[model samples]
Target: MDFGANWKHYDQAIIPLPPDHPITARTLSGIPGPGTLRIGSSGWTRKEYTNTLYPKGVSTANQLTEYGRIFQCVELNATHYKIYSPAEVQKWVEKVKNKDFLFCPKYPQSISHHSSLLNATDETNAFLDGIRAFGNQLGPVFLQLGEQFSPARKATLFKYLESLPEDIDFFVEVRHADWYNNPTELREYFKTLREMCIGAVITDTPGRRDCLHMGLTTPDVFLRFVTKGNHPADLKRLLEWKPRLDAWTAAGLERIFFFLHVHEGEHEAAFYKEVKEVFGIATQETQMSLF
Candidate 1:
């Protein structure tokens, strides 16, 4: 169903807050310009952010339709840890039909956690079926393995991956220190993925405490920058990552999608302003005129 890397400017979109009349400057500071469209936010079914986009107290279908207007794509995190029905996923697809929006679904935790990796047969099948059901609108599916991986689990993981369809674009998120301990092993892993033509989900977290840091591995990178509040300092740090991303692009990487997540704004508006300015994206503002 034409599943391949398609670049969408995700960090450019604004997450409008309900009470704020004009979007706060700090929240949108990193955006490029007003005319650029974005596939934004990590989750679509969120009521706190999306409810304001739709009419009050409407059905889920109606709310999703209104929610779909602001962003072109959303990273699906819910299905990563939960078991959902195909019928439920189809209903969501119907709600946003005829739109350019795409869904990048995360792999279920059962398949990622080494403790339960052996019993992930049912969950993996369900997750794959859901993505396939979404058809053309489905973005690359991510297998975000948590930080506790071990060498013994690698064989099972490879076996399972071999069972999947080749056409589907799947990316892996390796957070464990074990994967990085040996250079030869890491190179082999990256080589295998390149041979398979599957991208790697590269992650970079805040240097601050309690965040994950797995640096750039390949050119086709998906960066997840964890933001805590309106730390003006975070902006400068992001620039440090640019050289790495630029290197990837120079090496003939076809596409990259940088997903930005801010958890520490006093409110969403405050966070939005800081994002645009830091990233050097364009900003939009309105002024009142009296004659």
Candidate 2:
């Protein structure tokens, strides 16, 4: 989330709606079914959530249950650091089983960073096997390439992506500028992902404007929105996305997972509801369940 955290200055002006890429539009225009959406924060058990998201004395073990009552999905950042056993993942899944909730797990660094998406079959399999426990509760698993990982490694990256099980949805986020700096490479990136049926993760952080590359490789979109807590620009920036999202839905978008990176737990739910209201998504903020 710190990808754009430093140097406190960004355009508070609303970003305009972007024109769809030829490939994305062509692919979406053929789709006929309406799309679905899920909005949530990166995680649920932050210490800051004490009296807000969680009851003042609620135990950590029950936070997920409490969160399930409020949001429709969560970005599973925990999976990025370590692969948990299926039983553990199942325990988490059980907490939200009856709700229309989704767990969007991140690929472990072991496969994406240490191995750089090369020769890490064991790690990759372990991660997938563990997350599969989520069953219908699982959303797209995103492979976030480090800033050092550039387009030069596309062969290995593409092969690794192709090897992923088709039953499970996947998305990719590239950090290096090379992927966007070269127009040919940018188009190729979208073409490659589209042909393979993988979605793209659009990262919106102030420090890195290029990361906001607004092209959808598939009908689904995974956006990682980094926030400036309590900043007026936060709501303005998010409001601007509503139109772009509407445009995509018109084009062919079928699913969207918008994850927020807000630090203040007390105000997180409020912000979540406000933003979801902009998109006309109903909020469960009134749900009284506490665990």
- The numbered model that scores best in TM-score is 2
Question: Model 1 scores what on Cα lDDT?
Answer: 0.54
Please report the TM-score between candidate 2 and the true structure. 0.91
Query: lDDT for model 2, on a 0 to 1 scale?
Result: 0.81
TM-scores of all candidate predictions against the true structure: 0.70, 0.91
**Tens digits of per-residue lDDT for model 2 on 37-58?**
7888888877777786567898
lDDT of 1 by residue, 1-291 (tens): 001111132233222211211111211223332222233457655555533434567675575566565556667887867756778778778887546777778777767774446766777777777778777877777777666664446676666667778877777777666665665556556556655656556444433211122322333446565554445444554556555444434444444555656563233334444444444452454111100
